[model samples]
Target: MKPVVQLLYFGYHQAMSCIFPVAIFGTLALTRIWEVPFLHRYDAILLILLAVQYLMYSSGLETWDEIKVICLFHVIGLALELYKVHMGSWSYPEPGVSKLFGVPLYSGFMYASVASFMCQVWRRLRMDMTGWPGGMASFALGGAIYFNFFTHHFIPDFRWWLTALVFVVFRKTWIIYRVRATTYRMPLSVAFVIVGFFIWAAENIATFLGAWTYPDQREAWRMVGVSKISSWFLLVIISVIIVAQLKHVKAARRAEPG
Candidate 1:
């Protein structure tokens, strides 16, 4: 295949994989401009996301297992949101029946969308990894990264240290993905950075749509700081590790003797 054709094919697959996230962002943009009668914006978003999840499953865009994974990330994200809001890292600053301790229930779907993208892209691209660093190592690193998000509030931030460890842990790892008949590989760490950067870009859009407000944005809407990319980078690592571990487990079960 020609280079331009391969690039187009890759872009097509990436867009297809982004259906869930695109839906979420589209809803954010629409709800920002259009208000619903008898429903608060946040409540309406929650309802819309519920409907979207159902549609995705019914339409065979996501498998049952993928839905479960997305739900897990939803819970994880909501937990983080609750803590972050409590710590004054950011806030919803909106009234909604669906608000839990200040965060709208719909907010979790933002994180679930990330999980949905990971699962979708992995399947669409037929991605596999070499030098996986084993399940225990990956999960431990993931757990540490997650806890650091909260602990950093009370203690000194360890994100840069964690970032360094990520490089060391994934130094030998490479993700292999297929685009059409041709296969390509990239350093897994590099993939993390790329995904994180895009999510940071999306975060800027989400904040602009009034999804939430950071301390700086409460006065006026401004671009999210570039420093957020590091946070998202670690988050992308956790998401990837969880998805990769689940895929490994499924593969192991399939390999088991019947």
Candidate 2:
């Protein structure tokens, strides 16, 4: 009973740590049923999401630093969204007052939400990393991976090469996270795969909620392919590296369970 309670306590806080993402995705799911007086769905989504973000900051769920990181992700995500939408990888089908370059403004929040989650998780779990490949290597790898997301359309995709690079760079790295009173460790590469798998699951939910549609899902809603997990896995690495720089990522100590 004590162990069960401990696990539940950790789970609850873990969920709470994702309040920003929960709010964003939850709003995305809810707006399907919500009726607005004059606002288009996309516009409404942007407004409500912005409001929720501010609320999280004001309510102290997110610190100013976390908000800053989240904003950075918004820009990065938005840039990628613009490129992807332009390339016809996927699209925003609904008409939106806030649309620019065929990408809805709220679309960036999807990326911001990932940043928010990472920031909150880092703070809440007291995360650290060991054997990191150093800032320069990590940043260089991240840049190449991000570039591939765009250049793949016109050039040969180097994702497999980048994926191999990740292993070469991070093979010795491990993430240490505190859960409840216990500290646990996982290989950085394994963590990427796990987080990426979950992100793929979230993408499926997002598409089903009409947040956006892939080229394949426009006619009929279908499961996002399992293969996309590789893409998401690579994306999570980018997010992790960004947050690690901001959070002073380092090796974890042997913290005893309380």
> Which candidate should be chosen as best, given TM-score against the real structure?
1
lDDT of 2 by residue, 1-258 (tens): 878977887788779877877787888888988867799999999999999988899999999988988899999999999999999999999998899999999999999988888888888888888898888999999999999999999999999999998999999999998877788899999989988999899999999999999999989999999989999999999999999976664222224344
lDDT of 1: 0.95
| Model 2 stretches with alpha carbons more than 4 Å out | 249-258
User: Each prediction's TM-score against the native?
Assistant: 0.99, 0.93
Report lDDT (CA) for all predictions.
0.95, 0.89
Q: What TM-score, to 2 decimals, does candidate 2 have?
A: 0.93
Estimate, for each residue in 164-252, the C-alpha lDDT of model 1 and write its tens digit. 99999999999999999999999999999999999999999999999999999999999999999999999999999999999999999
For every candidate structure, what is the RMSD over all alpha carbons to the true structure, in angstroms? 0.8, 4.1
